[model samples]
Target chain A: QQQVKQSPQSLIVQKGGIPIINCAYENTAFDYFPWYQQFPGKGPALLIAIRPDVSEKKEGRFTISFNKSAKQFSLHIMDSQPGDSATYFCAANPNNTDKLIFGTGTRLQVFP
Target chain B: IAGITQAPTSQILAAGRRMTLRCTQDMRHNAMYWYRQDLGLGLRLIHYSNTAGTTGKGEVPDGYSVSRANTDDFPLTLASAVPSQTSVYFCASSDSSTGFDTQYFGPGTRLTVL
Candidate 1:
C-alpha cells in the first residue's frame, strides 16, 4: 500500500485558481505531515509541515488543511501561479521515527 | 557556501564491481540521511546517522553500507553493483529533532549499474 495516497496524479488549473491536492494515510501513529516540491533536475525541497496538534497552518499563499480524526491532510495553493507548477509530494512520519514515507507525487500545471 | 555536496554527479558501474558515493555537509548538522529515488516510487531511506560515530538503517538498507567516521562526511558503498541498484541517490541533513527540524537535501547523484 502507498502509505500516503495522493489524488489527481496530474492536475491542471488556471492562474489565480485554487489547486488542491489530497492525501490519505493509514498509519494512525504518524504525527508529522510535510509537503515537498520538486522541479525537474532538482531534489525535493521542503514547502511546509504540520503536527497533529494543529488543525491547520498557513504560510503566505500556501495552506495545509489537516484532519486528525480522518488521517488526512491536504495542500491548498491560493491564487496558483505558473511558478508554482512542479511535482508536489505529501509525506508522513511517526512520532519517534525520523524517516518519512512519501506519496507517489502530483504533477501540477498552472496555465496562464 | 556548500550546504551538502555529493561527488560523482553521474556514474556507470559494471555489475559485481564496487562503488562508493560520497556526501559531505558543511552545516555541521547532527543528523545525516541517505535516500534513493526511483521512477513511480517515492524517496526511500537507505541509511542514516544521528551523530559522528553512530549509524542506523532506514526503510531500504539492503545491498548498501554506510559509515560516519567524522561529522562532515557520510558515504554509501555498494559492495557489488547490480542493474537493480540503478537509481538517483540523495543526501540530507537535519539539525536535531525529527518533528522540529527540516531536512536539507543535496543535488543528488545518478548511478547506473549494468
Candidate 2:
C-alpha cells in the first residue's frame, strides 16, 4: 500500500500565480514532512520541511501548510515563476525510523 | 564537495545479464540508501545501510543486493537483469547522528533492460 498519496499528477500555472500541491498520509506516527524538487535527469533535492508540531512553515516563496488532525499537508508556491517548473514530491518519515515514504509526485509547469 | 556520485549515467542491458550500479559519497555520512524512481510510482527504497558493514532491506529488495564496505561506498548489484527493473536509480546519504537529518541524493543512474 502507498503510505503517502499525492494529488494532481501534473499542474500548470502562469507566472505570478500561486501553485499548490497537496499530499495525505495514513500513518500518524509520521512526524517529519518534507518536500523535494527534481529537474529532468537529476535527483530530487530537499526544498522545505516541517514537523507536525507546527501548523505551517515558510521559506522564501515556498510555504508548507500542515494539518496534524487531518493527516494532510500541502505546498504552496507564491509568485510562481517559470524557473519553478519541476517535479515535486512529498515525503513522510516516522519518528522511530530514518526511512522516508514518498508520495507519487506532482509535475508542475509554470508558463511564462 | 561531491555530495554523492553514481557511476554510468545510464545503461542498457539484456535480460539475464549481471550488472552493478556504483555509488559513492564524500560527506562521510553514516547512512546510505538506494532508491529506484519510476513513472507514477515515485521513489522507492531498495536497500539501506545504517553504518559501515551493516545493511538492511527496504521496501523493494527483490533481485537487488547491496553492500557497504566503507563509509563512502555503497554499491547495488543485480544478479540477473529483467525488463521490469528498468528505472532511474538514485543513491542518497545522511548523517544519522542528527535526528531527522535531510538526505542528499546523487545524480542518478538510468538503467534499461531488454
Candidate 3:
C-alpha cells in the first residue's frame, strides 16, 4: 500500500501565480514531512521540511502547511516562475525509522 | 564536497544475470540508503544501513541485497535480475546523530533488464 498519497499528478501555472501541491499520508506515526524538487535527469533535492508540531513553515517563496490531525499537508509556491518548473515529491518519515515514505509526485510546470 | 556518488550512470542487463549498484559518500554519515524510483510509484526504499556494520531491509527488499563494509560505501546487489527490477536507483546518506535530518541523494543509476 502507498503510505503517502499525492494529488494532481501534474500541475500547470502561469508566472507570478501560486501553485499548490497537496499530499496525504495514512501513518499517524509520521512526524517529519519534507518536500523534494527534481529536474529532468537529476536526483531529487531537499526543498523544505516541517515537523508536525508547527502548523506551517515558509522558506522564501515555498511554504508548507501541515495539519497533523488531518494527516494532510500541502506545498504552496508564491510568485511561481518558469525556473520553478520541476517534479515535486512529498515524503513522510515514520518516527524512529531511517526510511522515508514518498508520495507518487506532482510534476509542476510554470508558463512564462 | 561530492556528497554522494553512484557508479555506472546507466546499465543494461540480461534477465537472470547478477548486477550490483555502487554508492559512495564522503560526508562520513552514519546512515546510508538505497531507493528505487519508478513511474507513478515514486521512490521506495530497498535497504538501509544505520551504521558501518548493521543493515536493515526497507519497504521493497525482495530480490535485492546490500552490504555496508564501511561508513562511506554501500553496495546493492541483485542476485538475479528480472524485468521488474529495471528502474532508476538512488543512494542517499544522512547524519544519524540528528534525530531527523535531510538526506543527501546521489545523481542516480538507471538499470534496464531485458
Candidate 4:
C-alpha cells in the first residue's frame, strides 16, 4: 500500500503568488517529511524538509508545514516564479530507516 | 564531485532477457539505494545497501535485485525482464555518518521492455 498520498496532480499559479501542495501519510511512525523538486529529465532534489517535532520549517522561498497529529504536511512556495515551476514530491521516513515512502507527485506551473 | 552515476542512460530489452543497471558513486557514501520512478507512483525503493556486501529489500523488491560489491558500486539486476519492469531507475547515496542525511541522486536510466 502507498503510505503517503499527495493531492492535486498538477497546479498552476501566477508569478508572485503562493502555490501549495498537500500530502498525508497513513503511518504515524514517520518522523521526517521532506519535499523534493524535480525539473524535467532531472532527479528530484531536496527543496525543504521538516521533522514532526516542529510545526514548520522555512528556507528561502520554500516552506514545509508539518502536522504530526494530523499525519499531514504541505509545501508552500512563496512568491512563485517561472523558474520555480517543477514537480514536487512529498516523502516520509521512519526513524533509523534509510528507505523513504513517496507520494505520487504534484506538478507546479508558475505563469509569468 | 561526480555524485552518483548510473550507466546506460536508457535501455530496451525483450521479455526473458536479463538486464543489469549499474550505479557508482564518488562520494564514498556508506548507504546506497535503488529506486524506480513511474508516472503516478512517484519513486519506490527496490533495494538498498547500508554498506558493501550487505543488501536489504525495500517496498518493491519482487522483480528486482541489487548488490553492493564495494563502497563505490551498487548494481540493480532484473533476473527476467518484463514489461512491467520498464521504468526510470535512479541510484542514490547519502552520508549517514552525519546523521540520517540528504541523498544525492543520479540522472536516472530509462528502460523499456518489450
Candidate 5:
C-alpha cells in the first residue's frame, strides 16, 4: 500500500517534444501527490503537484494529470528543453501525514 | 543558503564504520525528514521529526537514527555502515502549519560503504 510505481525507467526526447512520465499507487488513502525535478548532483525540487480532488493541474511548462479512480497520476513536460533533462520523482502521502512515499524515479533526457 | 543544506556532500566509509550526515534548514519549518535514494527503490524515508524535540521512524528506519536538536538542524547517523547502506541521502523540511505537502530538499550526501 505504500508503493508508488513509476514507469519508463528512462526516457529520451528531442527539444520541443513532449515527454510523459507515469506513476500509480496502490493506496487509496493517498490524498496529496507531488512531482519533483532533480538535476544531476542536486536535490530534487518541487516542480509541481496536484491533489486527488483535481483531475489536472498545470504550472508553467509542466502538468500533472491525476486519475483518482485508477489510482494513477502522471507528469507531462510541454516543449521539452535540454535543461529539462533530469530525474523526476512522483510522490504521495496520506492526509495529515508527513511521510511521503516516492516512486523509483524517471530519468528524462531532452536533447537539442 | 535560503533553504536546506547537507554536509559532507559525498563520503566513502569502510564497512562497520560510524558516520554522520548533517542537514540544516534555514526555513525553520516545523517538520523535517531523512530519506535514502537507491536505484530501483525510489526515496525511502528513514526517519522524521515533526518538531525539534520529537521524532518518528519511517519505512526503512533500521540501521539509521536521527536527531532534530532545533528547527534548523536534523542529522542522520549510521551506527555501523554496511555495503547495502550505500546510496544518496536527502534531507527535507516542510511547514506543518499549512496542509500543503511541499517539502524542500537539500543537495544530498552521497554515501558509499565498502
Candidate 6:
C-alpha cells in the first residue's frame, strides 16, 4: 500500500514536444503528491506538486494532473527542452506524515 | 546558503565494513530524511527526523541507522555493509514549522560494496 507505481521507466521525445510521466498509488491516505526532477550529478528538485483537493496544478511549463478516485497523478512537460532531460520521480506523503514514498523513477531524454 | 550538503561523493567499500554518510543543511529545517536510490527502484526512505534530538525508522531502515543531534545535521550509519547495500544515498530536509511540503535534497552519495 505504500508503493507509488510509475510507468515508462524511460521516455524519449524531440524538442518542443510534450512528455508525460504517470504515477499511481494504492494508499488513499496520501494527501500530497509532488514531482521531482534530477539532473546528472545533482539532487532531485521540486518541479511541481498537487494535492487531492484540486484536479490539476500548473507551474510555468510543468503541470500536475491529479485523479483522486483513480489514485493516480501525472506530470506533463510542455515544450520540453534538452535541459529537461533527466530522471523524474513522483512522490506521495500520507496525511500528516513526515515521510514520502517515491516512485522508482523515469528517465526522460528530450533530444534537440 | 547551502541548502543541503553530503560528504564523500562516491565510495567503494568492502563487504562487512562499517560506513557513515554525513548530511548537513543550512536552511534550519526542522525535518530531515535519508533515502537510497537504485536504478528501477527509485528512492526508498531509510530514516527520518522530524526535529532535532528525535528520529524515526523508515521503510528500508533494517540495515541502517540515523542520528539527529542538531537541526542542521543528520547522519546515517551502516553497521556492516553488504553487497546489496550498494546504491546512491540522498539526504533531504523540509521545514515542518511552516507546513512546507517541499523537500530539499542533497547531491547524493554513491556507495558500492564488493
RMSD of each: 1.6, 0.6, 0.8, 1.0, 1.2, 1.1
* TM-score per candidate: 0.94, 0.99, 0.98, 0.97, 0.96, 0.97
Please give, for residues A14-66, the per-residue lDDT of candidate 4 as tens digits.
Answer: 99999999999994598778888899888888888888889989999888888
The stretch of ten residues in a row with the least summed lDDT in candidate 6 chain B is: B95-104
Tens-place lDDT per residue, model 6, B23-69, is 99999999999999988899999999999999998888998999999
Q: Of models 1 and 2, which has the larger lDDT?
A: 2
Model 1 residue A28 CA deviation (Å) reads 4.3
The prediction achieving the highest lDDT against the true structure is: 2
lDDT of 6 at B88: 95
Question: Tens digits of per-residue lDDT for model 3 on B14-98?
Answer: 9999999999999999999999999899999999999999999998999999999999999999999999999999999999677
lDDT of each: 0.90, 0.96, 0.94, 0.90, 0.92, 0.92
As a TM-score, model 4 comes out at 0.97
Superior by lDDT: candidate 2 or candidate 3: 2
Arrange candidates, best DockQ first: 2, 6, 3, 5, 4, 1
Each candidate's DockQ:
0.67, 0.88, 0.86, 0.83, 0.85, 0.86
After superposing candidate 6, which stretches have Cα over 4 Å from the reference? none
> What's the TM for chain B in candidate 1?
0.96
Looking at model 4, give its docking quality level. Answer: high
Ranking by lDDT: 2, 3, 6, 5, 4, 1
lDDT of 2 by residue, B20-71 (tens): 9999999999999999999999999999999999999999999999999999
TM-score of chain B of each: 0.96, 0.98, 0.98, 0.97, 0.96, 0.97
What residue pairs clash in candidate 2, if any at all? none
Best model per DockQ: 2
